[model samples]
Target chain A: MGRVVIDVMPKPEILDPQGKAVVGALPRLGFTGFTGVRQGKRFELEVEGEVTDEVLAEARKAAETLLSNPVIEDVVSVRAADGAAGAGA
Target chain B: MGRVVIDVMPKPEILDPQGKAVVGALPRLGFTGFTGVRQGKRFELEVEGEVTDEVLAEARKAAETLLSNPVIEDVVSVRAADGAAGAGA
Candidate 1:
């Protein structure tokens, strides 16, 4: 069966303390060369069977409703697991 | 400037309650066609200027040491933001 990968991230204007913490820790750990960082969430959904248009539509609906908070966060992309990041409907 | 994206996910055998919660809510929300769900973390590192080899290596080091917990979670990939996901040193 195919899988749909949904990437959810906070809106750019939103303050991401978790991401900022990581960025802040980088230099202390002696690892540098980064200016800023943003952290987000990714979800992989393994479909019981084939991945079809209907499946993608349902996945999108779920992403819009449950997986991500439309207010402060957005669904970056919903794509097939075996495919590219933006290869979803 | 270019960016690097690091994807961190819990091991497959690990019990992901967050993913399960989302899966359980899917059907109840009238969305179906999936079996299992996995949740992960995605980090977007925006370099101040350019994305070079040294930058990527440092990013990987950061991923291994800071971004992910090696015991329970693994670094799925460290890639250039403009490039494909697995395209990191």
Candidate 2:
């Protein structure tokens, strides 16, 4: 089996309440010296076979159309999993 | 400034409703050949200054204590951002 990892996050222009809340909580929780906090989502998908370019493209399409809301979020990446590139597990 | 990316996710054994929902939705949404979908969180923390080992350790502590629940979730990584290693942004 192969795997594709997709990372999605709110656009920089968008207001992320969850991220803001985390930023606010950190100082209250005694963790300091951090200026910004942006929270996002990560998805690990296990596919039936090799993760070819076609698979990666389809994954990106899925991310763009279904996994994330384009109005406020951005799909940062849709790539084969792990450090190895252009190959499947 | 420096960025520490902390990735948190539900343990492999834990039931992830959100992930399951996505998995179920994909095939209906015309994206097939996927077997598993695991969802997680990614936090990008921009620190005030250089990211020393001390800063990394503190980030790890924050992730362990606040960002992730040890019982059902795991902090996958707490590290300096990007390709460069052992350095600050």
Candidate 3:
């Protein structure tokens, strides 16, 4: 099966408490020199066929509507999963 | 600033309720032809300088120790953010 990857991130202007928590914890965990962090969501959708442009367009529509909240998040990427099985098939 | 992107996914053998819910809801929402959905996390970390190999190494360390639960999640990818404002600067 083909897989499409979707990435949704909080808009740059939005507050991301999860990201804040992570950035805060990094230093305490001794992972330093990080100035900031933003946490987002990634979804992998498996289809029965090849990841054609038609499939990608459908995935993009799904990404904007069901996968992410357009009010606060941006659908940063909607594309084929790289180099994976079925991606190049 | 340079940004590194880390992707974490639930191990294939693990149960993912969120992904289940999404896959279940998709057909109901009139989006079909998708067989499965797996949800994961994406994190963008901003550093003060260029994304050198050393910086990427640090990000990898952070990803393994802090960003993912090795028991349940896999760190799928960790690399410099692509073509963003600070990524190539």
Candidate 4:
């Protein structure tokens, strides 16, 4: 089996209300020294079967199409599990 | 500045619709071997100033309180940047 991690974040320019709310509440929670906070999502995936380049590419396409919003977010990075090191299939 | 990464996941018992959908789409994406996929969120944070145990603790608390749902989700892990390595403030 292979693993894939997906990170989703709001576009830098867009105002992240949730992030802003979290940042604003930090000091009240007794945290000092930080002026701002941004929040995003991370997804961990375990793919069944042998890891291949084709599998990786397809997974990435699926992520881009349904997992994240290209306009407001970007796929920061994509990596295959250590066991699957072959170049794209 | 210090960096904090927060991993949020749905409770094992709770059905993760998003995760389920992704898992179902894997085979169509040409991946084999695994049968299930679970998805979660990751937040990358840059906190200003020196990193202390208190800062870390406070951050954790904030995540539990406002960032994650204690009922249907859990904070899988929390980590600080290399620069901040002090024990509790």
Candidate 5:
């Protein structure tokens, strides 16, 4: 099976409390250098075979219509998952 | 300012109800071509100046120590947001 990846992030003007919580916790955990944080969503869609253009288009449609709220979030990307989840790392 | 993006996903064996919900909703919305779905998290960390090596290291450290739950979640990627989030799209 192949997979498609979709990323969704809050619009710049939206206030992200979850991100704020993380930003607040970072300093206490002694991790610094970050001025702000925004939390979003990532989706992996499993398909029967290769992630064809048709598949990507469907994924994008799904991203736009079902996965993210257009008013508050933006669909950052809808790309194929190249390999295993940990492959790139 | 530059931003660092961090992606966190649940382990393969874990059950993702949100994803399941989406998969169930897809066909109902007339959007198909996906067999399954897994939903995770995306984080953007804003920093001043540049995304230096030091900053990446800190982001990675924060991702590992604070952003994810070790027993269930995996840090998928910690990358530099090259420009305005909509740039690559």
Candidate 6:
């Protein structure tokens, strides 16, 4: 098996209200000296089989098709965990 | 300046209701052959100065101190953008 990780985020130009709220709440939570804190989402999947290029491609397609919203958000990256063999196979 | 990216997630044993809802909605969204979709958060910050260990440590402290919920969520990883030297300085 293999592990695939996907990071999805809104474009920088986009306004992230949730992130803004979190950032606004940070100072009260004890965080200081930071300006912006943009928030996004990450997805991790354990797939059956080896971490082949084919598997990676399929996962990308899956992400584009349903796992993420291509309109408001972008799939920033997709990576396979090292030593993921036999993980979910 | 440096760009620090932090990924936060619930531990593997934790139940991600949002992720579960997304996963349940995937098939309707046309995704197939995937069993799970776990969701987490990522924070990207543009900081002033070089990407040295000190900068990284400060960023980590910020994360642990306020940016993330250390009790319910773990700061899975932190990274610097590859070409962040002139971006935020």
Best by DockQ: 5
Q: How well is candidate 5 docked (DockQ)?
A: 0.69
Write the residue-wise lDDT of candidate 6 on A4-83 in tens digits: 88777777678989778867876676665556777788787766676678767877877676666777777777778666
Q: Report the lDDT tens digits of candidate 1 across residue range B21-89.
A: 988988898887788888989999988877888888889889989998888787877878765432311
Candidate number that wins on DockQ, 3 or 5: 5
A1-89 per-residue lDDT for model 1 (tens digits): 78898888888888999999988999999977788899999898989888888888889889999988888887877877775432311
- Which lDDT tens digits does candidate 3 get at residues B1-89? 78999989888888999999999999998899999999999999999999999999999999999999989888888889867722210
- For model 2, how does the per-residue alpha-carbon lDDT over B42-62 read when each residue is reduced to its tens digit? 888888888889889988988
Worst 10 residues of 1 chain A by lDDT: A80-89
CAPRI-style grade of the A/B interface in model 2: acceptable
Across residues B1-89, which tens digit of lDDT does each residue of candidate 5 receive? 88999999988888889999999999999987789999999999988879998899999999988999878888989989866774434
Model 1, position B19: C-alpha lDDT score: 91
Candidate rank order under TM-score: 3, 5, 1, 2, 6, 4
Provide the lowest-lDDT 10-residue window in model 6 chain A.
Answer: A80-89
TM-score of model 4 vs. true structure: 0.73
- Find the 10 residues in a row with the least total lDDT in model 3 chain B: B80-89
In Å, residue A57's CA in model 4 sits off its true spot by 2.9
Best first by DockQ, ranked: 5, 3, 1, 2, 6, 4
RMSD (Cα, Å) for all candidates, in order, is 5.3, 4.9, 3.6, 7.7, 1.7, 4.8
lDDT of each candidate versus the true structure: 0.82, 0.84, 0.87, 0.67, 0.88, 0.70
Backbone clash numbers for all candidates listed: 0, 0, 0, 12, 0, 1
> Which stretches of model 6 miss by more than 4 angstroms?
A25-32, A83-89, B27-30, B84-89
**Quality class of the docking in candidate 1, CAPRI style:** acceptable
Tens-digit per-residue lDDT, A1-89, candidate 3: 78999889998889999999999999998988999999999899999999999999989989988999989888888888866521210
As for TM-score, the candidate ahead, 4 or 5, is 5
Predicted candidate 6 versus true structure: per-residue lDDT over B3-89, tens digit per residue: 778777766677889878877876676655557667778787766566677767767877776666766677777778676221211
- Model 3: what TM-score for its first chain? 0.92
Inter-residue clash pairs, candidate 5: none
